[model samples]
Target: MNLETTSSWFLMAAFVLYCAAFIGFVLAVTGRRWADRSPEQHQRKWGWVSFGISAAGFGAHLAFFFTRWAAAGRIPTSNMFEFMTFLAMMTTAAFLIIYALYRSPVLGAFAMPVGFVLLAYAAVFPQEISPLIPALQSHWLMIHVTTAAAGEAFFAVGFAAGLMYLLRVVNFKPTTSGGRAQVFFVELTIFTVLAIVGFVGTVFTFKGAGYEAVFLQEKSSVDQKGQLTTTEETVTYTMPPIVKPYNSEMVRMTPFLGMKEPLFETPSWMNGVNAGRKLNTVVWSLLTAAIMYAALRLILRKPIGAAIQPALDGMDPEDLDEISYRAIAIGFPVFSLGGLVFAMIWAHKAWGRFWGWDPKETWAFITWLFYTIYLHLRLSRGWLGRRSAWMAVIGFVVVMFTLVGVNLVIAGLHSYAGV
Candidate 1:
């Protein structure tokens, strides 16, 4: 059928399927809890039901993506929304594989919500039906972007597991019941809750108090007319020393500040878009700060009692730590080969350079370095278990910067992937 018709249908189907998968994950967590008190038959029944629902949801999600690609007559990684969908699919697939191997439904309980949030974020932006730009019209576009997305998906899972390990280790004690599993579950819950709160707050702040403007200032300079005069010059005019806007309110709030002044402006066509995004960022930052403060207060209220109780019983700390390390071992190579090596190859072919210090490229290198150090620490420094888990957490933070922070905060060749 028509592109619009097909795209709309696919978007709707993807949303419904993701919601279904999220519910299935929640049910699976509930079933795991019930396994302790309920009959074996009931536990197995719910487990099977949960698996089937997730499987079906994942199938629908894949179909929606492939159909969109077919309708567009090209690969679907040209923009932020499509990239999000692709990443969500890859993450779900990876989570399912891990679940199959380890038989840990708890991973799904954490991963599905993250996938859902990303898909929902994708839906917030309008999907444009346009031909790929010449730079992205090559086959490597598919290979490079898809592989990078897969690597990102794996890192996302690693992040979830590492966070779980951290919570378990920090609250360690020798006598509490289900302490291991409880710590894992609590960590997942706290991460999910904070993410949601942060996202919502960002949406509200950007919607309420965001502004867009193009600032200009007078500078001491000689014009082309050959007479020296202080006159209004466009921000792009750099030969006579850049003009600096004097309004403190504007200077303080401008998002593209350099050492001397703001270097970019929100063009008329993009003013609303930039303002909205800025507002979202501010709101999310405030919300995150608030959640962190509240969590600290709650933790301090009964510090020893609260911390020592949940980590008393459950899985072995060493086992959890080992799992975290193993997951990173599997993901790190993929990230290096896909996000770095292949990306450079594509850049060389498309831009006549192997490396250009693009923001995306820089962040990718940072992520690679972060994980390389993690591996080194584990192998050479005799760091394992808790220390290794902490490294994995930090590595994932670097991965996040590579995947999201660079795209959002820095402008470069990969700007197309930001909304």
Candidate 2:
């Protein structure tokens, strides 16, 4: 088999191993009180077993990365599919390092799913190894992207630990107003994650069903020579169109559940083909998330947060809080080097400017500043425990928005990364 095909098999193997390891970690944390074995021994034995499996998975993931790099004749971090896989791998690597220091089964249980979801999310995009555009053909592609992803992986680890900390400590019933607000925010965070997972499932479901919608749009662009060029482009959607491309004509659409056409045209302000598709995707994702959340609520007959709180019963809130803080602390400098410093240098090299206030650049700086505040507040302003954990959680949201949302909502020089 070709290296490209071999690399895909390796990635599939890594994903399967990660899933199995997540189950093992969950058992390690949640099944410790079982009568079959001593709690300490069960925890210790399964923790090692899970860690070993996760490490093997990481090795397989590394093989996938290297083989893909060799097949593509460039670093694989040049596009969405490649970057997400790398990010997932780095997240697992970060979890392994953190687990070695603390031997925390709960961390593995939480962190492993983050990698799993990311790897799955990567699959949503096309996996073909296309040649990089001129803008991305630089040594800096590997240096800047990989380091930034490694650092963000730690932040993702921190988010997992912080989420566990909240699950351990937050009151489920929440009689008081403040307690109710805390419960709301925590549940909101969980729902957001569900939405992303739902988004992936929704995409694949329609894709597998061979759903198709086509729109023809006219695009106007100004060339470097200051001439206006008009072109007709065909945009296709795998999902049923809730909104068609702005100012575009429908070429064809297969009926879905008796819906023969789009509900409306996307607003003129949201003119790009990608923007319309993205907005429609957001609508479908939220709907799917609601259905999934309702199903879970009905099955459990309780709030999701309350159901998860039981697994975290014996875990210490303070330890989780500390782990979250330390993970971010370690990632901060690495992010500084990759997300800010090296990024600026590469931007200068590529665009002949260090900073252009592009959407991605602005968001990257904002992410750095947000983390900077997290560190400062924890160190100088006595924001530890619950407060610190909340910051870690919110910081992760900022990081994700920087990574994903900017591309979805805005167009700029970094638009290529979104594709």
Candidate 3:
């Protein structure tokens, strides 16, 4: 098989292995053991198994990546799909490193699921191989984007550990530290993760199903003779419909949901067929995830975090908190080098200026600022424990917004998002 086909098979196999690792990790933690005594031998044994399997999966993930790199003739970080997979890979590699340091099996239990969800999130994007765009055809694409993504992956580890700290330290009931907001975000994070899972399932289940709709784009032009002429362009998607013509006179060729008029028209620049379809897919994904979440809550009769708290009893809240901090400390400078410094170098090469305050660059600044403040608060201001953990969580959210949100919502030179 060609490298592309072989890498795809490896990717599929890695995902399957990750699923097994998640299950094994969950089983290791929640296996029937007495709370009064220390963790059972079987629990620890299973934890090793989970780590080994996850490591094996990471091997396949790396193989998939290198194979794709070989096939593409560049590092596979130019697009959202490739960047995301790299994020998953980095997160897993970071988790393994942390595991080596802390030897906390349950931490793997925590971090691996986030990695799994990241892979799922990556799957939501188009996976076909394509030629690199002009701006991305540089060695810096590897140096810049991959380093930034790797840094974000460490933050993902912080997120997992920070989540564990919350589960261990925070109370769902009212507290002086604005506990209600914490409770809500904690729950939202759970939903978001499950939402990612729901999105992957929804997307993949319909693979090979050539479902599509079309929208019309019209341009009115004035000739040198002062006569006006209008031309129409057709856009199609295998995904759901999102944007439509603003003019009431122009209707959708495919009347999705039986609505002739759209809720609002997309701005001409932001109205690319693929972009609009991706947005619509996002809406469907959230709706699907919401339904799944509701059904899950109905069956469980309690918040998922509360349910998982019991299994987390053996893990130290302080250690979890510290690991989150260490992850950021290690990742921040690398993030600065890759996400900011190298990016500025590329910007100078590509745009003839260091910065234009474009949405992606702006958000990258915001992300860096958030983490910088996090370090400032921790080091200079003596902010530690729950507050630090919360900052860690918020920082990763900023990172996420930079990674995907900018591409989805904002239009700019770098907003192509690997498609």
Candidate 4:
């Protein structure tokens, strides 16, 4: 087979291996009660086994990366699919490093699912390797994107560790208002993860079923000579349309669940060809997440957080807190180098300015500042345990918004990366 096809197979293999590693990790954490095996021995044996599988998966992932780069004649991070997969790979690398130091199977239980979600999210985007645009042809593209994604991957690991810390420490059965508030936020965090899973599941389900909708959007713009130009752009949707693009006519729509057409038009202020489609995807994700959550509630007959608390009974909360802090500490300087320093250098070469305050640039700055505050508060202000964990969780949210939300919700020079 060609290198491109081989790369695809390797990526698929890496994904399968990662899934298997997650199962192994889960077994390591939860299989202590198995007959005839000492709990410590069982966990130790399975932890090493799971870590081996994870390391092998990371090897496969690297093979896919380099092979695809060779086949494409460029780094494979030019678009959403390549970038997201790279992020997933980097997250695995970070997890492996942290796991080596800590030898904690619980970390694997949390971190592998994160890698799973990122890889699945990458699959939602187009996978074709296209030539770089003029603006993206510089070596800085490799330096800047890869390094920044690497930094973010460490932050992802920090988030996973932080989340595990919270799950271990939070009081599920609350007596006071503060305890209840903590429960709410923790559950909300879990719900957000489920929402992302719902999104990936929903996209793939409809895509595999061949569901489609199409629209013709009329866009009005002013030319340099002050002439008004109206253009028609075709917007396609792979999921049934809950809403159509603003000021657009439907070309065709496949019926879904007794809905023949979009239920409403996108708001005129949304202001992008695919804005309506993105909004619809968000709606569907939330809907699916709710359904899944409700089903889980029925099956477990308790709040998801309460149900999960038992699995973490023997974990050391302090160790989890330390791992979360250490991961973020390592990621902080890396992020500063790549997201700020290298980005500024690339901006100067490409756009003749280092600080344009573009949406992506602005958000990247915000994310860096947020992490800076996190480190400062933890070190100088005595924020530890619950407080530090919350900061780690919130920090990843900022990183993700900078990476994904800024592209989808706002337009700027880096919008090309969104595709």
Alpha-carbon shift of residue 318 in model 1 (angstroms): 3.9
- Summed backbone clashes in each candidate are 5, 0, 1, 0
| TM-score of each model, paired residue for residue | 0.72, 0.97, 0.88, 0.98
lDDT comparing candidate 4 with the true structure: 0.91
Candidate 3: list runs displaced more than 4 Å. 32-40, 173-177, 219-233, 242-275
Consecutive 10-residue window with the lowest summed lDDT within model 3: 244-253
- Of the candidates numbered 3 and 4, which has the greater lDDT value? 4
Better of 1 and 3 by lDDT: 3
Give candidates' CA RMSD values in order. 8.4, 1.4, 3.6, 1.1
lDDT of 3 by residue, 1-419 (tens): 99999999888888888889888878778773753446677676877888899889999999999999899888888788898889999999988888778766678777988887888888867788889888888788889988888788888898888888988876766566677787778888888777667767766765556555566656676899999999776655554454443322333344445654445555545533245555656666788889987887788777777777787877788899889998888889989988899999999887789899988899999999999999999999999998998888888878887877677666678868835
Which residue pairs in candidate 3 have backbone atoms (N, alpha carbon, C) closer than 3 angstroms, thus clashing?
79-418
* Preferred candidate (lDDT higher): 1 or 4: 4
TM-score-superior candidate, 2 or 4: 4
lDDT score of residue 77 within candidate 2: 94
- Cα lDDT tens digits, model 4, 80-135, are 89999999999999999999999999899999999978999999998988999887
